[model samples]
Target: MLTNYHTLKNLIIQIKPKLIHSQIVEAFTQEKDTLHIIIAGEEASALELNATGQGYIFLRPKFERARKNSLDIFPEIFGDEIRDVLIHKADRIIEILLSSGLKLIFQFFTGKVNFFLLNQKNEIIASFKNPKDNIGKIFESEKKDSNYDLMLSDFNAFKDVWESNKIENPVLRFVKSVDTIDMLTAREILHRAGELEAGRIWKALVDVGAELENPKPRIYYEGSFPRYFSIIELTHINLRKIEFDDINEAIRKFVIETRVSKSYRDEKKTIETKLNELVEKRKRTIEKVIEEIENNQRAQQYEVYGSILMANLNLIEKGLEEVELVNMFSEKGEKIKIKLDPSLSPVENAQMYFEKAKKTKASLKIAQERLERLKFEIKQLENLLDELALCENFDALKKFKEKNLEELKKFGIVKDKLVAKVGGKFKRFIVDGGFEVWVGKDAKSNELLTFKFSDKEDLWFHARGTSGAHVVLKTGKRQPSKKAIEQAGSIAAYFSQARTSRLVPVVVTKRKYVRKPRGAPEGTVAVEREEVIMVEPKLPSEEIE
Candidate 1:
């Protein structure tokens, strides 16, 4: 409890001597949750009040002013002479009264730091943070009669709270039940009391209570990094202790060392996490590219099929699913079966295979180009990681993040979520002609996919006789190709309970025709209209988005 009642009471008593006749030069903020007020008297001093996740106030020795990125606030208080400084009751609020009758209140509640300026009437005129909430309200301390002060005042009061507190460890209980007692004080008292029965917890409380009235502040360190600051002698922790003549000096040094180091470590960890995600994404992309390159090896085989179809064009009949013909490139002259679209004529079918051969050849070239570029990008990412690993300070880590933020975001790292996907519980895939196919992952999502996520014209699919994902082919306004419908059908089969079957019948219908029956369980839907399509249960190799 660095900003505890007694500590702050002492802090104000000590700091008042310096600020008593000081003239208010300026008050400003350079960052969030922090404010600096520059005052001049016999000596120029700056009070840095930081209400971080934890609240702390430190006195910087000089009248140091931030050169840039600083905005002036409380300009009305300028040139006012400081008359008195006092703690509000037993709470962690400091009241600074000026000669002009304006009062500046600094409330240092944990996780809630608020600065307020009040008039002679005690009505708030302005505030540093949320002005609308504080303005015109008569400001007051929240814990004016809080239980912490009563617990410290008498033994019976302490015991009453101690027994009511459910925390098994008295030390942890003290920190949780008492607002002012922090972990450092609790642990020190526990250490000094040795082993105390439930009835004798009062003995442990005595040491800490006495220490609070009379503090001997010091900073504790591990190796070169400052770990903690305390007013009591922390014998429980074995660490290097640097004693300070003044509690303010101890707090200043501890806050600077620990918080700065924490910032550096936190920033470095974020960079490392993003870099690792980038490297993994690049590696996965490489694998896909490599697979595409391997698939391109069948380009000559497609060409052979095209040549054979063209050669036997006269012999081939229309409406045939497959035609057995002598292979043009087969060593043994073995007859091969080539599948065709029954709707297309013999000549059109032959040209389709030829176009497939041409596209596959071009795709091979593109894949090779993409692979080389990916390798170069991966190398660059690795170099960035190496440089980041060597960064020694917060500034160095910050500079590295600034330099590579764009590159990281380009690869889909945005803040805490890496490569955030489209908001849904469904797996999405894109088919030929940019058709988006959505497949539900569970029963609840299946209900959402069929009725909520799909439009009236969207095509929905499900395995005919077994449980399956409700698949939607999002072909808004455009009629889906037969191939696209078949792809969606394959996805429906693959996601169904009958996926292992060689061929599964999938029911296809407009989303408008599908309805959840009244009193039906989740994922159970009735179809007013449906058409069955049979297909091999094989999904597209493309990654789900």
Candidate 2:
């Protein structure tokens, strides 16, 4: 309703005489796409030019500029302003003629709203949206003939314009196609006329102008929220109305209320998007952790295999890939085939399986701890979604945001790069028995992985006697099984100089036993006690299992 020409014409007529020779002290933007200009004359007044597509302009008696986050703008026409502020014919474009051969034009046309400062030659000096092509060009307002102007007070002309247009609503025929008659004016005219007959519409159209001449400004509200404000009295939608003698005052209050409501809606949508992404990410983590826990449960089976290999070491010979033996624990007298390292003696192979079983048991505790933490995080995110539904006001949303800021940041919602940096310092993977395998990327990082990043008890691996990235099985106060070490070794072999080789020997040792010699080359480390595992050069993703 405020965008309608009749309302704008009345508003210009009311404020033009008041701003005669008023000094524009300041003009700037303090909010997103909202412009403010301060004026000092008989009374202090301000103009809020909300060029956020709605193009709502309000003249206010009192408006305090915010102390922070406000930028001063449009300094080109910031001095004295004349009272000759007029709307362009019947269009919503307001042209304010300055005494110093400059003009400030605010176009409030449909779809596109713009502000331009023009020099004496009507060339654009500056614009609000920074239209690069429009800056040096001669400004031109649209010059389409209005249906309202062509058909006013004539029944046949009104009927001809109304009949030629095919539309659903009779009110929209005037509001959408016609320029002079807006939705409010059209609805009020139809409501006053009582029907859609051409004779009645012509009479109402002629009579509506008289009503606009002496408008009783009103702001309509559904419940406590303002929905619409109009100069001419609206009889279309029934709602609570507050009448005002000053039109600008009513418009100011209504715009502020609706704009804040819109902000609240946009904020809720942002939070919901953040929460949805977080829940999906946490659920994925839970799936990975659960798979690790299931792998950890295989520790007992590894112990049984180690015991069987130790009992049958005398029967097993060296240089064998596998040995089939009767399972002592099986009631069906099942024979189990156990894989062996051909390079190791039978006793050493048995000891290696025992070591694997011990580490797998140790890794279970760490996996269980991680599983619990991930579960709690996912449940907390889901509950936060429920809590968000009750947020009604800006203060409630602000409090919700503040309360969950730390939790949201922990799950990649805020400061995402920082969260990823803390958790993803190395190329990491979860191998068998829930052990985390951390791989170095370069020569310098290889030294850090063995010395600075790894704990003393953590197992370290590298492709033996070849330039390679260091791989660390993050023991985390636990031992990792041979399967975990093998997977980590595979990752280390894949990133090394032996990557093209069919088989590579990866040396495994505790970080405590691995040390850099004095004045050693980068990534050159001497191992006091290390065991070598022979495997094909492959990454965990490339492995069959």
Candidate 3:
């Protein structure tokens, strides 16, 4: 655990950076509490730190070695600015003073590991955790050098303070005494002495306190995983002590490994969340589009009014702003109101209603077509979501990210990239007789398979008068056997709307006969010279490679 006081002390010594002042090249946040800071100097190094829990500080490798995409969440505060790296002589905090006098403080104390970047006027700039309560209210003024000293004089002062005050918690009392030791080290000292009272553990505490003056860093591990690191030798028998010439190297490897694992988990969570949100939003869009199409269809009533006005021209007079006439199309012959333009003649007004009816009919057509396109897009997004669910490793997730990130960018789910087209590949299946059959997974794939990938002579099959995949059988310019054609028909039927039907009719034709009309929706096509076959919707029993 990096919260140990001795651990931070050893880490600072091990780093021993030659340059105290360096420019902040960039800063990238892996998650909410973890970040990577790049400092440029004669020998540049990237420093990694986590503040939420199990936090550690180490010299990380270059940006290329980073496993996840680097997000510039806070680009304005930490980029290309010179900062003074100040490791306080005291063991509690590491401060990075910026050119603008803002100090980025990394406090590595137990139960309160946090990062706080504060302005020169002591106002908080940015923090990792609860800034108002956890950081701002609790920060105490720095004590004198004598208070932090681990020698006999400071020990006497702690002894006087302990005797005069009535503190119940032993760990809190120890912190007030030494002003630098954490709870873990305090508990370790008491455990080594086999005592709970302060008086009884005095000798062991002094010995451990003296070791802090001359540090010997050691990392404790549990079965190849780093569990705890400290300057004093660990007392537990189960833990294996890993000795390192430089503790910085040890902390670096351990923190990097932990970060790599956490980064993937966070990335996967982000993808899953975006996919879920898009699915829900697209569903709402489809519903709203359908409602709009229905409203446009209701505008067909404009035609009936125009017909009524034409039938009752004698009832209208010159300069009549409005008219009341029987709606002949209605079964009850109800009187309807027809607003008129006083400047236009009765005939021209009737023509105006006729023109409005025509425009409404055209609007209805456009709305229906738009609704179909929206539904197709929803289907495509659902297919993409299924593929994301099957992403079991980093490489799969990475490919999904690279391909579908632009789709998410449309909704501002991921905003740092240009728009690009993405879709799942076609599903391939092997049928009997060693023939290869390809099935379209979605609307886009259907068009791709039928027009772009399939050969002119290849046999194509689809469920008759229904929405389904375009199934292509690779005939290789040779006529397939009756069994292969029948099997392909079954696959085509199974992927269609009639999948549950006892018998489905599938239309079979050559690829050259399937022509997509200009500006048509995906997967829609006109067929010529088609042959219909009746088959039960089912998968082939045995598929060969």
Candidate 4:
């Protein structure tokens, strides 16, 4: 509810336990001739001035403690003529009230005065009014004694009624007590009490009484209620302090996790490189050993062939010795063969050579097979290492490890014991108990907060008629308080263009009312059956910290 005139009036009536203090420090006239009244107590104010030349009435409080220089009221209406007149009249009234400590001072032209009285709450109560001829009479009748006591009669009436009298303000007292009496009935009573003689003023007061019944808090511009301004009460909770601690913790955890993952990735990469280098070195060594064995085998084969040729030569030499007579007839044709040494005889040499060759072949085959198996084993190791390298980081490694663990259960590689963070760092939890509120920083985040995370029962809020981040209150099973709603609304307003605005309008609705059309952009949604709250954005104390 924007604090329009009607709403302000309603609030005043509802919380009618204390003094109503209205200080109009400034005013503005819109192009539509509506008067905007900026009050000090209220964050923002507005009023509509009529197009007609006649001006509106404004009433102010007259208090005893008011200083001579305290009233700095100014008229900010459109025309210089009326503006000058209003400024002059306000100055005169302030002067009179300051000098005489008058409880009521009338602006004769506008037919309004400053009224001050005490309420049940012992708070200063005040309002604006038109000067009534029967005001003295009304004041007299309200008092038991006929003395001309201003404070003792009007202000003290509420305080003196009961020891713990709750009706301390005059307006509240009047509203609460005078139920049966009509306006005329009360006027007649006042007429007789003070012996008022001015009929015209009395009639005007009677008309003012009607206006006060449902007083819309507005600035009077051109003698009429052109633009109505209201006062809206915004209730909010202080959750920034609580959320700040949680967010800090979340950020800390996120940073730690990120660092750890990066470190693990770096370490894994180093291990993979070292393992690959070792495997390649082992493969080259095995290949060299196989080549050496092949060379040794070829050398043994050549030795066997030499041994066979030497054995054949020894047999030819023995035959030549027996046939010496034939050599004389054919000396040119005779083959001269030298006898081989007995220590290097053919049979003994062949046995020695065969044994060496057999032994060499056996050893070479065994070494080659062993080398081949080792190379195959190394290849398998390299493949496994390659896979491990692709795991990227600890998070991925952990997932893979977990999966492998399940598989390893069949082979019994290790026992099962899972230890890991169950949720991500960015995951949100409830604050102020189990209210599922989600906050986001931007449009994309807002979309994620509402559509992706928020439940149907959650309520959504945003600054109305402006761009703002979306805020969702997760009302799981609990009813939201006025304070909580206000706090969320403040967040929505604070993150919006209207953050600097005096009073920002925030629209809130249940999640059910919010809908996203097909193919709509992020954070774009339609809503129905929502409430509007106007509030000044107040940053949490913790936020400043």
Candidate 5:
């Protein structure tokens, strides 16, 4: 669900080395039972190991730079502890760590091997399995460039070397391949293997064959020295079988949630700042207006406008303020908390302050209303931005932009420019077979198309009781077919706002009976003795050019 990069980064920071190892083991392991192994000691020291549920095992040879002294058998070199571990789980782990929050690491002993698990913010949430081997040789050979390759090669060779040894589970075999692990690789393998359920690790191997056959499967190697290695762990068989619809749905949900959070944060800040500024400005303006009104010598001449007060009065007593030299009231039935000029008469002060208060209150209300509208617009714009950012394909983005432009035009947010000269224009539409239809964009257009451009024998169609574009069907000296009539009716309905309305009524008559209404709105017309047709909305895809 975490879409932001910062959130995922925090989660990775909180991951513990042991849990990373456990995750790797769990991913590769199919066994439900616990594992037992020894670390930094012989097999007789048998350590009880818990199953990590998912994991992988990797092996590497012990080697060092040449020294002047003769080489001697070093038993102590074989007992170093494993150092690096990589875990894979839901992306949530990465999200939490990247958020700069706390995380908990859990560690325990199965027998001789140590086990560890990690949770966000250091809170103990779950337990994980332990590794079967100490991985000391692999951990100590960190300086070599070919360490990762050696590890994988060693793991693959493990089967041959340990063939005579008693190993019961197939999971152990797959675990040998784990040099490194990550969410994508884990998910790819587990999902294709159909191992989301508790049991079914072998199914993963079927696809592994297909992976090995691939000429260039994706591979990942550690970026640093003492490098670890991992392949993409996916096969062509899996790619062909895997469906991404569910993944796409998850991505969409994450995008929406992110947008909502951002919108809320932005709106909150804007509303608070704007509202505070408006309140302060209103208070100051009201005081200035009251001073001017009280000092005016011709205040009495404005009695009809509203009572001008010379002295301070409660808002309830002063009532509404009138706009200067206008009939409109400004005092919105509210009290003013401003200091009154003490030099003026009570009645004069009351009238002047009341009027000022009224104006201020009205101005404040207008400001608030405008702010609300702007906020709504901002929210819509934010959603559009989010959609643009989240759209995965270029085609979808183009369609979205086009839809937004159309909506803006419909709402009068954009001005329509006269891009072309006014002249005769006609559109010919062929519908459902060979029946040709024509339509006009305006009244003059209608007259030109129907009376002049179209033949008298052709059928004419228009929306009933509504001023809309005129449609003409050119039958060309032949009776119009039912398909042609239906097609024309659809056009008539679509041109009007009632296109989506059920059973839209359309009028059909001979081209001769239709007449443009003189001095009426563009596209308005009167038809006498026309047949009515009620039809659902739909038009043929094919149109006559």
Candidate 6:
């Protein structure tokens, strides 16, 4: 609750904050919409103030260490030192004149709590709600009222004032006559007196005064959450009461316990949830890329089948359903059964097979490019998530966000930036010929190895006609030896689906011939000017020097 006239009067007397000229070390926000000030010296204490309709001003036992950011306006006003603290008579404004001849007015006037710092000339210097922005007019001074004179315990003194007042409404008249009494305080007294009539009003007023003198500050909680705070014990027995010896503590407890803190916690949760979803999505994309790679490899077989059909066309006849032909491509002239369309002639059937092969080649190139891009995106996201997890406070989180805005934007965490960072170092190995070879553990790394990391002079290898890692051999000064090429081929073959095969065909070529087509996925690439070498699939043992 805001310091009503009575409460403010009592606090001024209790605190007795004078012009000791102590230092104002820091001013910042821990909870959202709350300003905290640390005053050091003889009166070394922290002040917490909030002005968002339910605003309250109170002293906290300990400073909120988890400050999100330092207040830009506070430093300009106080200059790290305070000269004097004065409360206007019967007004809820704290006038703090700094050592620098600047005046800071903290007005707790029941709306948004606003701070105005004025120069010696009384001109606005800087403010939380800067006057230059035209948000609202800042007053030079608050209008003060006559201080309440009657002693709190004296019932006869209140009786004389009530009798003299001509106002009709008991509550309204009580508030107008007395400087210190607030609406809630008046209602509380009336409720306790069990009557709204003038006769019972005196008794209620006396009770309220006595309660205010020895305030038993309590916070009322509904369903295990704090709802409101009161100076006296509340009448609601159904609600739980948490008692505090100090009124400031009670107010601090109520302010800290809010939905705003919960929302910040929820925001952290949302970021984590989004990170997990991105990781899962990357995994699915990798799987799809692998499947596409395998399909394209099988499509390569279509080209071989078409060639065999064309060669044996002389023996083929129209209306023939099927034929057995010799496979010239194989080591042995292996007999293969080829299905034929009875309606089409031999030449037409051969042309159809060639057309089918051409489409598969085009699709393979596109899928490879798409696979490469997805892998790159996934790597960047993983790095971004690592940075996110390190953020302990909102300030740190905000800084991280500022630094990695583009990365977060790609994953839909922030606004869309439509950009990406692709590729990173992959696992490396050295062959007997002293050539360093890189092996990709995942789709993204594979794309990096083939298209980004390796130079045009370097060699590239992958398992022929199958899904495998894209391996890069760095031949800096000399051409890679036969042993090095074979070893690299083995590494590629071992990483492929044909790892179990005793002998697997691996396609090896220079990096210049490895091309990433537009819109291809991660780990998919088109190889040209390639030479196929058959080797037993196995992983390289020696680490790169």
Residue-level lDDT tens digits of model 5 in 25-65: 11111234332222322212222223232221212111232
Highest lDDT: which candidate? 1
Query: Tens digit of lDDT per residue, candidate 1, span 1-545?
Result: 56766678777777789989899999999887788989888878889888666678877866556699899989999999999998877577899999999999988876777889999999999998889888999987766566665666677877777678887776788777666676777777767777655445567676577876788887887766787777777888999988877888877887788778888788678877887887899799999999989999778888888899999999898899999999868799999999988999998998898888887997887688668767877887798889889887777777776787656544444341412433657898755544679888899889877777788899999999998899999876888889889989999999999999989999999999999899999999999999999987876545454
lDDT of 6 at 275: 78
Model 4 score (lDDT): 0.44
Write the residue-wise lDDT of candidate 2 on 145-227 in tens digits: 55665666567877877777888788897676556777767888889889877778778877776777898788888755678
Please give each candidate's TM-score: 0.59, 0.68, 0.50, 0.24, 0.24, 0.47
Predicted candidate 3 versus true structure: per-residue lDDT over 1-545, tens digit per residue: 56465667666666646325666777777666787788776677777888765477877555653567657633555654554565566656777667766667787755678777676666665666675564454344364353545433454565566666566787676666665677778777767768555455666777787777676667676544466667776574458777666667767766654555467668778867876777787688778867877877745677777788788888898699999998888899888998889998888888888888786776676567556655665676677778878876567777887887645543445653211221236665545444667888889889888988788999999999899999999775667888789889999999999999989999999999999998899888999789999998987633322
lDDT of 4 by residue, 485-509 (tens): 7766776787788889878889999
What lDDT does each candidate get? 0.81, 0.79, 0.71, 0.44, 0.43, 0.71
Which of 1 and 2 is ahead in lDDT? 1
Q: Can you tell me which runs of candidate 4 are displaced by over 4 Å?
A: 1-247, 299-303, 306-346, 398-545
lDDT score of residue 33 within candidate 6: 68
- Model 5 residue runs over 4 Å out of place are 1-341, 375-379, 382-390, 398-545
In model 6, where do residues sit more than 4 Å from their true spots? 8-14, 17-20, 26-32, 42-44, 61-71, 76-83, 99-101, 133-138, 146-183, 259-444, 447-545
Indicate whether candidate 2 or candidate 3 has the larger TM-score: 2
Which is superior by lDDT, 3 or 6?
A: 3
Q: Candidates 2 and 5: which is better by TM-score?
A: 2
True-structure RMSD for candidate 5: 26.0
Against the true structure, whose TM-score is highest? 2
Cα lDDT of candidate 1 equals 0.81
Model 3: CA > 4 A from native: 14-16, 28-30, 64-84, 87-91, 97-102, 109-177, 197-200, 260-445, 448-534, 537-545
Order the candidate numbers by lDDT, best to worst. Answer: 1, 2, 3, 6, 4, 5
Provide the RMSD of all predictions against the true structure, rounded to 1 decimal.
18.2, 10.1, 15.5, 36.9, 26.0, 13.7
